[model samples]
Target: MLTNKSSSSSARLTFWLGLVGLPIGIVAGFLAGASPLLLCLALIVGAALLWFFTSFEQAVIGLLILRSSLDLFSGLQLPSAFAIGINALTILYVVVALLTGKAVHTDKFWWFFVGWVMMQSLWVILLPLGGLGMGAAFLPSAIKVWMRYFSWLMIYLLVMQLKDRVPPEKLVSLLLLSLVAPISVALMQIFLPASILPSLLTAQAKAGSNVSGTLGFPNGLGIFLTMFIALIWWKLSTSQKRLPWMILLGLVSFVFVRTGYFTGIGAVFLLILFINSTKITPIRVIGVVLFCSAFVYMFGSTEFGQQRLTEIYQTPLLNPNIDISRAIILSYGDGNSFNWRLAHWNYLIEAWKQFPILGYGLDSSPVLGIKDFRTGSGFAPHNDYLRFLVEQGIVGLLGFVLFLTVQGVHLVNLLRSSPPKSDRRNLCLLLLALFVANLASMLSSNIVDATTFFLYWWTLVAIAGWGNEYWQTHRLTQSA
Candidate 1:
């Protein structure tokens, strides 16, 4: 006598219960001296249950949380953990999307980008097979490097599926909330003695060195915060609750400066200038002028800041008397970070000459036997563009450039097509700012190597996509 709807609900409940209980039963049986095969079966069943039961939203949030929590285990240096977690969650999300019949939405340009990436990956893989094959010792690392690069595509696909389910604003809010942990860790690092801090939350730093926060490197933390400063400032500008947002912005900026990353500081200044140029108003102009004045004053007041500013404007490279190549080699011995980078760049440029088309394959820089003047060993060039040039070659670099260009064009279109003062336009502008800031940071830091930074970068891309789709849908609905 039960209704059809009630019977269907009961069936669904029973099915889920069985799915959950089966894994537990398998685990219990294994604990009770069951065959080793039972343990393997349990693992498979558990993985399948996790994949099937986890919603897309949950997977997205879980990925973000897992990335944020990585700094807590910095001592382990477990990048493999990040690679595995991200890949697993992404695959699971895709499987769920397919099962739910959700369309994998993407534009023609995006498809082309994906196809190009695949081709580059294939070339890198086959390059070794075609020539002096990849060393057995280097094979696993090479595969990992490719996986890390490919993960960005997976992230984009997963977020695309959730474009309608998750709003861009909510994603940004989550990111803002995630900042709390790192900021708090930074604050503790500043206040507490190094010996007193938990090893997991602190890293090796020079005596009296600036706080690095959860990222473990002071410059890295500065670069990370710099990427978000413009976006936060944008939010501050649009927000009604000015006092709280202003306070938060001040706190983040204070942490940013304390990291003592001169490049990051310069990048922030450039971003401010860019924002001001985009929309010049009387009030905005005044505010920008005041900000610039304060910025100059703050740096001028401190000897360290003044020295950094001087280095930025007048490095030894500009001197005609200094032989650039000799100076670069000497810089490694002189302990000058800037000069060391120049030397690395020089080496990488020379190395690129050997494999100009496809390069020496992904992650080949460390093992390609190029001499590192600093440590008497091979090392990755700190500059990302050089890394791409040496590792992936010209073809890889062009593919990357094209991808960025297409993304930039799409963002610009979204910015222009959206109504003035609309959420979509605002979000697009913020994403653009974040993208430019990260790109600027790449000159000095291989920002993409860090999993957290990777997450932040691609999440911005996803949010931009979300904004575009949301706006288009709203326009169509209104017209209809």
Candidate 2:
């Protein structure tokens, strides 16, 4: 009887799997105009072909190069199989991080990061307890977004653990070259005709000059341009090929300006402030201030620049002091981007009251109807602060804020301690500028959800934060 029961259970499992797969097989056959068996064979063959060229390490590197260049996570008009591949790859990454124990570092950043992680993890339990009622329908998207956050955390851990394994000079050189493909492609997309490249390389078919570069948005492209430019300058500080790199910098800056986004203004300003690698003296600061003031005055004298400044405001006149808080609150109703933002923010603010402690789960913002319904297609909340407050609630937001605070304090300390005109100081200034720019950009963009952004951001965090110590340790070990 026991043998019979085992056989019956195994048969039932096979039957259920077949029942589930039958529809999928039929759909594949109908869509491809081929037999089900042929479609199945093709899938297996394709997977085999892909597998031959793929490995865990290779996938991660490709993620750096390709993901930095493309917006794979956007889920826009792509194949369903791509999503499956991403999910599988993320699972593999998480497994590796866990098995290596790299995710459990005892650093202060780890404590804050893990606290935020734990809060996100608790969403499954929290979202259903008279809260947003975390539905099964949203699980796939939720998991994907959660995976993105986890991927960032994992990369930070890996960098922290392995910063000593590679030299900065070699890595920077490799990246400077590897990044050329994306930058070149972006240039073509913007300056050349879209017909010049295949559809995979150019999304400008429907929309002329989709300045998204490979990342899928103009601002994203702008962010990328500024980032790589900064990296070039970092390399230039120590590089022998100063003239050629300087020319490249000029060309890239020209492209960045055409992007027409001020997202990197703060970062660019900071970079200009310390471009000489001189000590941070008050005189140096005042000179930069005066120089910027003169430039602004000259620029404002131009007709186009005056018009641009006028367009930035144009919010209807309001009471000067109806109590500062009330005046700010009333400003949200103005007819502009601010109005759209306030609409979603107010909606989110109200929704958070449902579960004040833990608002909703990761990726829950989309389902909350927070997107702009202006053109019938939804829009994302450009602000990261609102994203954290609504999705992670107070605890998650607090943890995130604390992590940022730690980052700020650490960078300030590094700046003060590192020798002026040294590699360490230059790196610190570069990292500090990016940090400030990134924070400012967060006020109106989703810089966090970006893939290459995190890779670039975390690498600096590791290097500027603790990579030097690791480098010193490596040197000592080698010398000994």
Model 1 segments more than 4 A misplaced: 1-59, 75-79, 127-134, 204-207, 293-307, 310-314, 317-323, 367-377, 467-480
Which 10-residue span in candidate 2 carries the lowest summed lDDT? 471-480
Clash totals for all models, in order? 0, 1
> What would you estimate as the lDDT of candidate 1?
0.67
Give the per-residue lDDT digits (tens) of candidate 1, residues 1-480. Answer: 447756765676566567868978866686658677777776786675565455657657666755655666656766567666667766765554454444566655458657865865664566557532244455667777777767777767666766777777667667776677778888888778878988665654444546678776777677778766766776766666667876787788777776777767667777887765667778777877776676556545555565556554434656565566766776756655676677777767877787787777777776553465567777666777777777777877887778667877877776786676665666677767666876777787776676666667667766666644565332211100
Per-candidate Cα lDDT values, in order, are 0.67, 0.59
Candidate 2, TM-score vs. the true structure? Answer: 0.68
Q: Each candidate's TM vs. the true structure?
A: 0.82, 0.68
| Tens digit of per-residue lDDT, candidate 2, span 1-480 | 977866765676566557857886776768578566777776886575356234543443444455564463355633233434554555554454454332423356655666666656666555545454345555666666666666566666544543444555454455565456656766777667676766665553223533555666656666777677778777655665577876776666655544444445555666666564354566656755764565455435544345445534542334333433443365456434443455566667787777666666767775564544465544556778877777778877887788788878878887776655556666777878777777878887777766566766765666555544543222111100
